[model samples]
Target: MPEYGPLHGETVIFTGTLKSLEVFDLVRQYGGVPVSIPLIQVNEVEEPTDEKRMKTCSDFDWLIFTSQNAVKAFQSKMERFAISVNEIPCKIAAVGTRTAAALEKIGFTVEFIPTVFSADVFVKQFKPTDGELNVLFLKGSLAGSIIREELPFQVVEWTVYETGAKRDSINSLVDLLKSRRDCSVLFASPSAVRVFSEDAVPSVGWSGYTIGAIGHVTERALLEAGATVDVKPEIYTLKELVETLSNRKDEFR
Candidate 1:
């Protein structure tokens, strides 16, 4: 028989959209049975002003992306406007490793990534040159004001995408929680935590499951929602979250 990993037959439930199979594979590699209960959907914002901004993207000194969704939306807009990668002359900043990898995959060079994956750390650690810099933050509608409010540089935020709860997944998730209390549930964003809290918690309650959050922000959301965060990765990535959860399998067991 093949050797099972630490998770060994544990059900790992993801409460957000699958960005890629990386997290799922990681969970499976650790002997966890990964399950997807997508509770959020992200869609690019299509507006005339957005196109205008993309057209003059080179006007900014820096382009900042705080999430992979922003990178995806930015890439879609770039293709829509026939804007080539070489046409964008501004330096790029990504908040996390996955976000940086996404930007790099699109042939764009990422000039800055903070020591940590959070915006609060990003503002503190990201040291740009001493000058008047016009920075454009490409973000989602649900993004917080940290980048805009904290950064010392002249920052203009463009909402490139919007996040909404996937109402259809509520029933499915509630059903899973109702049936299986041993599952380790992972939340990637505050949006997903909110959806699970508002829609699923009232029905099934989240006490029995092993709650996992990807980052501090999401962990705060879970705490605010009155759910105890059982597993949280210090690195704030889905793969890390899974590995962290797997490492704590004994605690949950």
Candidate 2:
């Protein structure tokens, strides 16, 4: 048996609105079972804010998409505005493979991508020649200020989508927590942390199970909610999270 065999036999649950196929594979590779039960449902808020929509591809020199949801929302609004695929004038940038893939599916090739998928690295690699270089950031409403704070040029912020906690998901997660013998829960974003706390934290006491957070923001949310954060990777990306967890398997044991 493996030294971390006990850790592998444990169950890990992932909850959020985002997809978890990649995280699931990583969990399986490390001899852990992964369960996904979304705590929220993601949906576009309304028609893109008119000012923000007009400023996105037309006025900006570079358009930055941090998530696939942002890319999809932007594309949907582009269709509504009657903007042809080739009519986009700004250079396209994506923070992750998923966001890049979303742009690629819409016939836009990514002009720049950072080695690390976090906002810090994304802002680090961003270079603009002119002070007038406008940057349009397509992201969620709850995102932190990385591009806005770091960039020297003008930034147009747009909130394309918002996530809300779902009653069914909350009920399901509560039931799972009550029945499970030994399990770990992974939180990928602050919103997920908020949703978990709002729904399951009161009912599902956090005495026995382990809690893993993806980044500083999620870790802070977990801590503030009175949950013990057992695992937090240095790098914010999913790949780094898995690598960190796999390497630190002994700690869980």
lDDT of 2 by residue, 61-101 (tens): 88889888887777777777777767777788898777798
**TM-score to true structure, per model:** 0.96, 0.81
**Winning candidate number (lDDT):** 1
Worst 10 residues of 1 by lDDT: 1-10
**Candidate 1 local lDDT, 154-195, one digit each (tens):** 999999999998989888878877787468889999999888
RMSD of each: 1.5, 3.4
Error (Å) of candidate 2 at residue 168 is: 2.6
> How close to the true structure is residue 125 of candidate 1, measured as C-alpha lDDT?
87
Instruction: Give the runs in model 2 whose Cα sits over 4 Å from its true position.
Output: 1-7, 48-56, 79-84, 114-116, 120-125, 250-253
